[model samples]
Target chain A: MQRLLYSLSGASGQHYSPHVWKIMMSLKHKGLDFELKPVSFGDISKIEDGSFTSVPVLNDQGTLLGDSFEIAEYLEETYQDAPSLFDGPGGLQLSHFVESYCKTVLHPTLAVIAVMDMYNIMSDADRAYFRPAREKRFGKSLEDVYAGRDAELSTLPEKLNPVRDLLTNQDWFGGEKAMHADYVLFGTLQWCKVCCPDPILAPSDPVNLWFERMLDLHDYMGRKAVSEAVAA
Target chain B: MQRLLYSLSGASGQHYSPHVWKIMMSLKHKGLDFELKPVSFGDISKIEDGSFTSVPVLNDQGTLLGDSFEIAEYLEETYQDAPSLFDGPGGLQLSHFVESYCKTVLHPTLAVIAVMDMYNIMSDADRAYFRPAREKRFGKSLEDVYAGRDAELSTLPEKLNPVRDLLTNQDWFGGEKAMHADYVLFGTLQWCKVCCPDPILAPSDPVNLWFERMLDLHDYMGRKAVSEAVAA
Candidate 1:
């Protein structure tokens, strides 16, 4: 029997990145036999110090794999018989674009949003809890970051103009097909909306419709409809 | 006839980011019937603010393949018998580590070296010519950067520790065969040596030996012998 396991966050499952939940929920809906193991990116001093002996690794019959992109690749390769999110060179191209969008553009933008959202939603005591972890990673004062929020937020709209342009009247970034890239982008966007609800992306674009459609995917709403409803 | 076009800048070539060249040389050696065309990364305006249309796209039979890793993957998939630097899952793992090292550590390190080599090696007027682009890409403040060079340099040791620990005094980064990862890392190392000679890595430990073996490779040395004889 084929099995899969994901390292997830236990305490901050409230602030869990949508990408993680997407993978977990996808497997669950498939009714596949799998296990979920919580892995902490929040305070991964062990990873930082190079004791990455066990972390977010996907195991295929006990063979461990690392790197989210690599794990995705391995899953695709190993489960060749499984329902595919990839189509061909075209699909690969689309997936590659989504990865780039997430890695280079959206991910960083979402990170900035995370800081803003934490401050906005969290209590003084609650903010204190997250601030230290963030400080370790960014080495910046949250007050200063918060002070410059409008300026930081302003630049994103222009940065997002290109993404918005791509989304203009399109059902998905990868065109008509709901490929892996769409799901990947959706995961990041979902996170961004929670972590940084910018009105710029809220206006009518075909992408918003696509976002709504993904919520209707099997187990997607079941797993997190309550959470997403709150965030939305 | 199958064709591929590489977008390039003759001067940005000086940064000697070997990931660009490794792909170039790989294609050159792969003996695939193809053509190379140079394009600009700065010409995002031409792309009209689209998604992830970054450097080094391979145009094969009118299909656009961007992202060097994906390009390599596409070629490997499309051409079964092309001379492959990567072979299997271990090959994938090694290539990933090399990519991670390059982006996270080596390329940034080498960029510093490239500037210095250009500074030390370039004539006063030639320095004037290349300064703006370097300044634009890296930053205008060389003295500030050079001040923290030792600190930044320390990260290289820490970063390479994984490869070093896993290698355990081996012939290659991925066991016996010189795989894609070795080539990728070697390309960066080679670029750094040419662009900036460093005591840390120049007369260093495993780096020195690894350098020798990489240069000893027929394809690698062939390029070296050409570059050495040519006046850059």
Candidate 2:
């Protein structure tokens, strides 16, 4: 069966959507060969017969799947004999906890820190749609919303204290192996890495070290991905 | 073989130490029969031997274990035939993540919100030790530390947003069944319930609902425990 993953991309072909990256890593972990189809914001709704409105809409043997978590669940159940994304019973809940942590704690912080950098890297059409939507959400212009970027960026390390402490004791969030939980966090960090030049984690920090190790996984797929910030 | 768990308690015999509660819940989950020995802050160092200086020193068949996480590991490994505290592979890491969350996020916030209540509930000896130690940690008097508690308490719901979101779709942090991850968070909330008059969670919140369900677990052990704040 042919598997194709539709991922959100930048003008320079940088795959930066955290949700899309999550499914990419999950598919790789399950040893599934998949092709990536880059999509712009304007192209999302038109994919898979206008049924979906998001990046990471996976087409597996002509069956369309949306939402990273739902796609992960589908992959886990369908490819049951393949290496498990969730190591065991409690893993599904923990992976969801990691997802929530990324959404509630990390995403907003990253959005503020990388607002201008993200704008600089997007296609003109995406930029047109991004500004008004984000301004409406923040109730402020992009420039005004990102004015407190330094203070927001300083809070990132403190917010990541739990993850740092976890990495201090274990090699991965999934204990010995990197599972969906690890990928969930990796995707968030990867989003920042792909779009922003300022480093989210220090080189000496355990989380940064873990990120480097994660980049080496699956034949250095993350390391080889184009960083729009670096490219520009 | 007899099993004994030394737990930190207040003057009115409320088991309020979050660390101790974690072991209590773990022991129950593993189906191990144990006795709870209530101790004050001053009594911690003198529990099993002078080697340890903390509560939750588990004495099992002559083997002494300190640290809640270590005690849990010992229980899980030693009682391999019994039920597991960590349901599977990733569970250990996720359980640790929950522990780190309680330590980094919840503990400090709870300490400030319940400072006065905790001080009031402590034994005279523990009060002398707790006040100076805590005051030094905050670099202020207990009164000053607690003065900003209303603001600090307000941030707790936001801090607990991840857990609340996790519980929205699952019954527990441990997925279908309550495991160590559930116990890890339960211990933190249980500490506040035991020591403070003000409820940390609103009655209608998912976290509050989950707490009520947690209290009913292990044959109502948490619900049956005395609340020092309520007693006074």
Candidate 3:
């Protein structure tokens, strides 16, 4: 059986979609061998039967799955013999909490901070689709939104205090080992690292330290990702 | 062996301390029989030895434990045969994240919103102690801090988006059942309900729905708490 993960990619092969990275780490966590098929944002909907609307549409030997959380659940339930993605009880709830934190708290902040940088790195077709879509969502031009980038970036660390505080007492968000919760956060942080040159987290910050450890996970899967700097 | 939980109470027996409520729900979750001993703010230090300076100092058999997190760990370890508090693997880390969320995000906002109400409900001695201590911490008079109550209250529901989003898909933060994470948040919401007449969460919000379920937990332990309106 062949496994394939369709991921959102940049012009220079940068995998910057946080949702895609989550599945990437999750597949590796379950010890599944898979191929990464990169798709531009404009091409995401055409990945399979044109029914899908996003990246991270996983095809597990013809069994198609969409949505990162749903795919994770599928992986956990199907590959029960492998290491668990949720680890124990409350894992699903905790993972969802982390996801919400990223979606509500962190993503908005990052979108403002990385708007221009993200646009510059995207394929022309994706850039054409991205600007008008995001501008409509923000009710402003991309340039206007990116104008407040520094102020928006300043709030990122404080927003991450809960994660930092959790790390202060435990090695991983999954308690002793990295689980879906850790991957959820790691994917978000990795998105920022890949798209933007400015460090979202300070070097001395505990979150950065955890990110370093996360980068070293699954045979340095994250470390091997092509960042904007490396791509440049 | 006798079990007792020392909780901070107001002049009219209003048990409003969030930390104390966490242990209360936790004890009930573990099905442990215990007494809730109410203490004024000034009476905390003398609860056991003069070394302790907080509520939620749990006396299990002869061993005393301070700090709600520590007491939870102790409970999970001591009552290994009972219903677990930290349900599965990442329970500890997730519980801590919930605690940090309440402490960092919710508590400051609540402190500002409930400053006057909390002060008014306290005993004379506690009022005197709390006013000066909290004022000094905020670098302003309690009255001045309370002036910003409306603004502080407005920011609370937004801060709770992560929790609200989590509750959108799951019945409890502890997944299928209420665990330490659910208790952690329940304690914070219960503190607001006990300390003020104002509703922190809108009655129709999903979070409020979850809070209702939480109140119904442990044989109506939370529902039985004396709220400010009831006390009045």
Candidate 4:
């Protein structure tokens, strides 16, 4: 019986999905070992009887899980003796607020900022499926979406102000230790780190510094991940 | 030991300061009874020898405290057996993230949206001080600052998406019960509820519903407050 994680991979095999990176770091945080199987855009629906539509689908020795938040909860409940991801109920619920921040504030901005770069790094089959879908969703051509990204890019720091403000007084989102809240935000930034050619944050920014520290966590799993931008 | 909370009040003696409201709710949440003392803008500098510059100053029998977060930590540490504001360190730290959200996203937008309303509710003396100070800060006259508020008002909903998204699945920021994070946001929205003439949230919005629940907490403390908007 083996644990397996189906992840979204870039053309060059960089595990680039933000949601997948969340569970990837969370699994490592819980001291769980799993084989990472890369899946392309077109391959997601075919992962398990066409039931799942996203990556970070965990096959934990026959128990299949889909959403990243659900997978995090499963890992926490299943590995009770391991280091707790959420310290208690307060941490657990507030972690959702962090997730909300990532979704509403970070994801949408990063999506526009890195759309073309994200498209450029996708497999041909993935690109074929991605372009029309995203173009329709964004209501613009991929190139057109990429054109106004400088304006979008300029807004990233302001979009990240909350995290920057939090980091001004604390080393991590989880206070003295890193927790799921930290991972939720790290996952968002990690997406841009792996995809965007233009730098998303300043080197001296507190959030950027926190990201640097996050990359070194879990024995450098994030640092060692097959980053497409790094490979370039 | 007498516990006294110096709160900022409007002309009609409404406790309108967002930071003060946080401590007000947190005090009640911990079941610690304190006398509420109203302070005008001019009186803040004269409070306890002019050292402290803000309201929500907690004078717990001569152990005067300033800063809402500091006061919260003091309560959490001083009263270990009471119902915890933060369930643990994780919750404590994440509450700061909530604070950051209130400061960057909610406060700025609400400040613009309710600038004139806030001025109108203040005493004539406060209006004089507030007008020049705000004009200097905004680089515009009070009327002009408020003239452009409709555009600012339109941005509030999207700005509040993070909180709205969080409340969809959970009863409160603390999951089963309210915590400091809930108070943190409650204080923010309650500021608008007391001062803003136009409704800041839709009647059916999840955030508005959560706020309604919040007002009813602590035996209708929020509902019982001398609301200037209610008086108007």
Best by DockQ: 4
C-alpha lDDT of candidate 2 relative to the true structure: 0.86
Q: Is candidate 3 or candidate 4 better by lDDT?
A: 4
lDDT ranking from best to worst? 4, 2, 3, 1
Each candidate structure's TM-score, on Cα atoms with residue i matched to residue i, is 0.44, 0.94, 0.95, 0.95
lDDT of 4 by residue, A28-132 (tens): 999999999999987888886579989889999899999999999999999999998988777888999999989988888899988998888888999999999
Give candidate 2 misplaced runs (Cα > 4 Å): A227-229, B227-229
DockQ of each: 0.03, 0.70, 0.68, 0.78
Prediction 4 global C-alpha lDDT = 0.89
Q: Write the per-residue lDDT of candidate 4 for residues B1-232, one digit (tens) a residue.
A: 7999998878878778999999999999999899988888899988875788888899998898999999999999999999999998888989999999899888888888878988988999899889999999999998998998999989989999998898998979999899999999999988877887677899999999999999899999987773534774
Supply the TM-score for candidate 3: 0.95
> Which residue pairs clash within candidate 1?
A8-A38, A8-A39, B7-B39, B8-B39
Residue pairs in candidate 3 whose N, alpha carbon or C atoms collide under 3 angstroms: none
Q: Per DockQ, what order, best first?
A: 4, 2, 3, 1
Task: Write the number of the candidate with greater DockQ, choosing between 2 and 4.
Answer: 4
* Candidate No. with top lDDT: 4
Model 1, residue B221: distance off in Å is 2.0
